[model samples]
Target: MSVDAKARYAQSHEYARLEGDLVIVGISDHAQDELGDIVFIELKEVGKKLERGQVFGTIESVKAASDLYMPLSGSIEAVNDDLQADPALVNREPYGNGWLIKVKPNNAKDMEALLEAKAYASMVGEE
Candidate 1:
């Protein structure tokens, strides 16, 4: 299980990383590993606005389906269409090409309220 040192984490296992003006969102490496092989992903449409902690989408794997939560309040700027065709990218490159969404946060400062990498790692017992 890998924790992104540059990303902030929610207790629910989602991660938020700032990249320029957009915040990139995705399930953590530990999450993908726990979920087993991913088969499908359903994400909200671009431009949808959601509050922090809102259900943004769902990810289905061979083991089970899990609801994805918003780590920050934001408008959906982009969804990773690549996952529709190759969901295992999540298992292979969770923090890279497998990232789930790009959000335009309502308040970038909200990221400060999330867990740091070391804290998140400890929460998941990866520390």
Candidate 2:
């Protein structure tokens, strides 16, 4: 699997990709693969502030349901409504169209602290 080198990941499997001043967030491909086919997603409202490592949502898959964590402290600017209609997009395109949220990150340093593609892949045993 090709992980997005531009994106950073949390130990918990959430990924954050910087785009201008906002950060795009989502579950990593590894997480979705582990959970199997995603069936439902419950997300925090837009404009809600969330701390790093906070449970911002829940993802239910064929295998099991999992908590979705915030990779950085910030206010959610947008949620992917597309997922409500086609949740499997998360499994199909986790690094692209399947992204879950857009956040205005609170700290640049926090963004830097996340795992790089190589590190994250190694952590997940994909390396």
Candidate 3:
């Protein structure tokens, strides 16, 4: 598996990647690993508004069903529908095809508040 890229991370384990006003959101490799065998994912719909740190979805695993939090405040632009059919993509390519949503940021400066990959790695005790 590829290491989590140098994207921004929320303490809740959500990751964020910015592309213009679009901020892509997903759970980190570490979070997925900890969750184990994802069976179902419930994502916020496109056009949904969300606040940073707010619970927007849920991921169910063999072990548990956990809340998915927003890494940045935004209006959901798109959601990965592929997950409704096969949640395993989150394990296969979390940073790419498995991303959860594209959000149009409501506060651009909020991106700066997320933890960097290195810092998140530290927070999760990777180093």
Which model scores highest in TM-score? 1
Give the TM-score of each candidate: 0.98, 0.97, 0.94
How close to the true structure is residue 69 of candidate 3, measured as C-alpha lDDT? 93
Off by over 4 Å in 2: none
Residues 1-127 of candidate 2: C-alpha lDDT, one tens digit per residue? 6688999999999999999999999988888888999999989999999999899899999888899999999999999999999999999999999999999988877998899999999998887
The total number of steric clashes, by the backbone 3 Å criterion, in model 2 comes to: 0
TM-score of 1: 0.98
Could you tell me which residue pairs clash in candidate 1? Answer: none
lDDT for each of the candidates?
0.96, 0.93, 0.87
Task: Give the per-residue lDDT of model 3 (tens digit) for 1-127.
Answer: 2346657999998899888768889988889898889999998788899888788899999999999999988899999999999999998788888899899999888989999888888888886
lDDT of 2: 0.93
lDDT of 1 by residue, 27-124 (tens): 99999999999999999999999999999999999989999999999999999999999999999999999999999999999999999999999999
User: TM-score of model 2 relative to the true fold?
Assistant: 0.97
Clash number for candidate 1: 0
